[model samples]
Target: MAERRHTDIAVIGAGPAGMAAALTLSEAGLRPVVFDMNATPGGQIYRQLAAPQVDATLMGQEYIAGRSLVDAFVTADIDYRPLSRVWWLDRDGEGYVLGVLQQGHSQQWHADRLILASGAMERGWPFPGWQLPGVMYAGAAQILLKQAALLPSAAPILAGSGPLLYLLAWQYLQAGRPPALVLDMAPASRYRTLMRHPVRAWHGRSYLLKGMRLIADLRRAGVAIRQGVSGLRASGSDALERIHYRHAGTWRSLPGTLLLTHFGVVPEPQLMRSLQLRQHWQHEQQCFVPDRDATLSAGTNLWIAGDGGGIGGARNAEREGHLAGFAAIASLGRQPTKRRSATTRRLLAARRRDLAARPLLDALFRVPEGWLAEQPPETLVCRCEAVTRGELDEAIAQGGSGPNQLKAFTRCGMGPCQGRQCGESVTRLLASRTRRSPDDIGYYHIRPPVHSITLGELAADDFDNTNN
Candidate 1:
């Protein structure tokens, strides 16, 4: 049965942004109830270390910083619940009601203000043989290493752009398991786009140095790197046998059992979109982001923070969370005139400087035209229903009105993933064939129950009255 729970503040996700928000709000004398689907608090970026008393040096400075954030959140005066998945959001008087599934039981969690820090998901890079058993995301490989301390069976062949691809290879190299090959999607001329103001670049020189060091470390470990690479395909009759690619106007193949790739990341907006928040399409990030005020407030009762709201890294997300914490507490009618204006100003400035190089990153790591383009008729686009790309195209050709309308024809967005894996690809592929801009194409008409939960859980749930 569902239980009625009242929280002054409800923060979703336990990543850097969520933890930062909870910590800041706690300092301001508020107890925010935090719900994280992950068993631990660090979200993905700061995934908890292998052991409680392990050396932080091995995980690198990024995870070290994440450890500090997790520590702060751990000590905060907040009700922390791990392994809690929120599947629905509803209007509750001036506040909101969250349908949360915790430990296999449903509960109605209420709060005057809600903050979403659900984080981002890897951009899909569908290719031939991608559905094969061994072709997985580079981020997924990193997760195995981070959460379970597991390494690939054999040296991996990484094909993708973005710092994550490089970072993961570097981690493998650092751990004495250098990648077999790194097929970089970035062009040689990408450095030209990085031509930024000296002072601005110098302001973020530490990060710049880190990038150089990662590349240098990987090279030192004898990892083969091929830039401007394209035409990636994984082929195996039983398992992943080899990867084929075209490089320097020639087709080449690499003998490998695993092919890990990622173009970059985009916000996972299923929750935000389901709630019908104000969303805008960010050109650089090539995704829809929820719109919010300076305080991160979307409305009187809704606040969104972190990469789920936008694609800033952990540092920027933490800053946004801090600001949103204040906004949320004030919205809930709690304030003692305390503000972190100076800190917010500095964080915002640093965040801008940090992301100043993002356009270059975006250009360098962009998926090739049709990388997510319509696949062959037999190629699966919607993995949940086994819907193929040709089917999607045919549905579009059959005079489907838009992305949402195609659901009736092909059911692309109605899968268990609810369009996360195939949503962007479907929209882009549709726009390309229809000669319509993506803005004109529109997004999936997402409804409630954004995440999966058992019907038995909902059917047995108790509803709380909001009239009080």
Candidate 2:
């Protein structure tokens, strides 16, 4: 039989938001259980290094700040279960039933409240040969460098929009191997264009400073930094050998062993979607965000924080998480101290101001038009089912092949990756061919056992395992 556990609150994900929420809840006299897929509590923003003795030197001061927050949570005496993947969430009476797989065993937990802080995922823009062996998301390369101190390759091309591309490029240069080129999709002039909103520009000063630092370093290193590269493609048969792009009314090809591309970040809402929560289009960020109240409560005893709500980065995520914790405690008929409430209100206001600038930033750094169209017909669209663009197009032409029907017909979304890499592309293609809105196309049907589990594990279950 699967083991059963109970807690006052169950926090999904161990990133900054989850850790902050768990710590606040624990301090308020509630025992919260924190579940993380990784073996550590830092999440992606505070990703720890493989070597135990390497202090904050490798990750820089900003990342070390995140480490300090993790340390505080560690001292708060909360139940943290690392390496636990939560695949299902069901309404149980007035609370929630969380289905988790830990160390190859299935388990369940009942919590009076649940906080989702699953964080964000890198948004990808498809192009010719994007599925090449050495072509990867910029965030993926950063993970490798953070956890293993390994660069993507000696001569890599960083191409994309947003601040992360420059940050990763700087990291690669600092690690003794400067990237071959920095092909920025969003031109530098866009920043000046956004300056029309003084409040927004002022709020984003820190990000601007970081970008300036990267540009200065690139100039000093004599690394080529192109500000307007579009129509990117990778070339070579087995592995990535070269990257081609167009810039400033000219086509340029750079020889490199690896290509790192990123458009921006999107909320990692797989668990939230699994729960059938209402989601709405966030036009500012070009992504879907869970419908929630000002206090960050999704509904009932369920709360969502951090990038799972929307991409607000670390500072905004922490503020939102603390508010969710206080709101959860207040729901139990316990009012926090007046001073604490006032402080939280102030922080929340600042977060609002910061998040208000997201629309301008998103507009300046949005994904290019016709990005997915750049893909060849043979390019792999669905990595899970090995479905090519040709296959998806054919399925759409057959009629009645919406995103869900296409999944049923081709098993396009029925993979371990859970459609993270291909869902957006598939939805766009379906909408274009069906002449329907992307929202009308809808998402795939998600069921229990969201991730693959061993057949023996499923057979050993004793309780009723039904999908909602």
Candidate 3:
């Protein structure tokens, strides 16, 4: 058992939100301890380039924005813990106790105030042959490019909705390795409707302009662009050798070696849901989001910031973190100086402007109606347990109406990923079966250890002797 360290504030996740929160709390005469799962501070949006690598040309000029945040975090007088995998959280009197696994040791810490900046993960919706070895999420592909300066060893094939897809391909083209094809899931109707709503879309003009710029660049480079693609599948015995897709009602097959896909993102809500915080299903984002104020507080002593609450991109997350940090001070009846408050208010206004275009994106990339509309009984639904759609059908036929109940019946979500990879897919599948909305279907009951921990680590010598 590690010693029970104590602090006034504990911020989880070292991304833009948590670091920004720590910086704000430090300026308010408080020392906040920040913890991150990764070894370094930068989160996904501004992920730090590999150690000793300061070259901006490789990771791109935009990555330079994260340097100041990481630097400010290092200079702050706050305790920072990296490679700390927080597993469990529990209410203890007026505070909270966090169960953490660090460096192969299990430990616990107590905090009077908790800030959750857990960040986001790429949205996963099962498509045919998605489980193939050579297929991966577009976000994962971007990580490889950012962290290792790596590119596909073979021709890259990208498909699905959202801007990230095109952006990653553009980055690949910049690296002088162009993809074999681009299969867009977005139908023409979505863009036509978006153009008609310029009044509401104007607020998110920056995002719109950036997306257009990426698409324009890819087209100029002679990248094959196929819009309104469906029936996407990978075919090969040992690895992906061909991509089968349908465009304009014509079935076609393209030779490819890698298949990258994405459809935007959603928060990793395991920690928030494990805390039993209030959350609701967001139809727009097609995921659950913690209920939070503009200040980002969800409970009296609990605050949520960043994409973990909702997807508003990196800039909005930083602004939200500042608000949540200052709000923590105000909760204790300690208003920050007017200058600080004024700056955060300005950021808050910008955050709102950034959020204005979300509804438009939501409609355009709405989870493909066909995914939940029908399921081929032979297709795998739970990749971890090898549970198939046929098995799920039997479970539902036997009245497994909820995700939790399905887990008990077929072990659909009891996997190493703790349902992160399959929760949305499972929920949508059952929701369709029961003729109810996903909210009515509910999510799996999340318990912790959130991530796996060794048996010996849980029984380490540092545990409280009184309990033993």
Candidate 4:
């Protein structure tokens, strides 16, 4: 039997958003339980910040700034559960029940009011030879660098469109290891979008300055950067040996042992989707975002914050967390103090300022079109089930209307990953083939057991359980 417990307020994820929410609630005299899948606090953006294995000087200021957040979180009175993965969330009467797996045991947690701050994940854009051993995501590479001071050998090639791709290249340069080449895949359409929003460029000048400085740094470090790149392909007999991409109407080949690719990031939507919450397709960002109100309230007993709600980065996430915490406090029948109200207003203003640069960044880093058209039929779309593009096309030709029908026909999403890696690609492909909006095509109908667990773990009863 699963263990059960209850809390007045609970916050999912221990990233910047969740930590901020919990801290705010704790300061307001409510102890919120925070569940984090990682072994430590500080989600991906601040990973290993508390006990960094790598050098702080090389990681830069943004990373070092997380120390204060993690330090406050550690010293707080909040209940922090590290290495605990919430696999299921269900509405139980007026409350919510979360099924969490930790240390090979299943436990259930109940919360009167919940705040979800689940962070984002790197978007997977598949191509030929992407399944090779030496192919990896730039985000994954950054994680390795942060957690283990690991760097790719043999001068890897970085290919993708996004600030993250360039950020990773800059980090490598800081570590005295530079990439062989950086292929910028941002299409020409990005300029038109930018031109249409000149005001956004002015509002987000700081962001633009930072991006320019990063590019200049890479150039000073002698890193080869190419723009308008497309048709990225990894080729080798076994591991990655060569990267092929098109630039300026010419196909160029670069021999490299590792190929790090990153298109962008999207909200991790499994838990929110499983709860049957409202979602809207964000065309500018090219992903689905959880629908919420001004206070980030999704329902009577739930609030969403951070990248899980939308990709507004760390500062935005922190302010949203404070707002959500205040909202949850108000929902509990407590009137906000005048000071708290003032703080809330300040947080709202700061959040808006933090997000001022978002429109410009979104337009500049938009995912390029023709992804499916550029992909060969043999390319693996769903790496979990080894589903190829041709197989999905055949299933679509056989009257498969949506992701669910295609899953039934081709087993495209029924795997260990459960559609995390391929869901966006699948949705985009269906929308392209059907000439419909992604909103019409919809996302996968996520069910319970968002993360896989063993039967033995589910049945274990000797482990320490909680009921409060």
Which candidate should be chosen as best, given lDDT against the real structure? 4
Scored by TM-score, the top model is 4
Residue 13's C-alpha lDDT in candidate 4? 97
Count of residue pairs whose backbone atoms collide, per candidate: 0, 0, 3, 0
Per-residue lDDT of 270-329 in model 1, one digit per residue for the tens? 888888887776777777778887677887777888898878788878887887887776
For candidate 3, the lDDT comes to 0.82
Tens-place lDDT per residue, model 4, 1-468, is 654888998899999999999999999988999989999899999998989977766876778888898899999999898988999999988889988888777888888889999999988788899999899999999999988899987688898989888889998998988998999998768768768888888888877888889999999988999988877888899788888998888888878889899998999989999998989889888899988988899987899999999999887888888899999999988988999999999999888887887978988988865587458999998899999989999999999989999999999988899999999898999999989888899988999899998888778662464432
Question: What is the Cα-based TM-score of model 1?
Answer: 0.93
Clashing pairs in 2: none
Candidate 2 deviant stretches above 4 angstroms:
49-58, 187-192, 459-468
CA lDDT of every candidate = 0.79, 0.79, 0.82, 0.88
> Which tens-of-lDDT digit does each residue in 155-257 have in candidate 3?
7999999878888888888888888888898756877867888876776676678778888988999998888886677777888888888888888897777
Off by over 4 Å in 1: 1-3, 50-57, 196-205, 333-339, 374-377, 459-468
Better of 2 and 4 by lDDT: 4
Cα lDDT for residue 230, model 3? Answer: 66
Q: Indicate the worst ten consecutive residues by lDDT in candidate 2.
A: 49-58
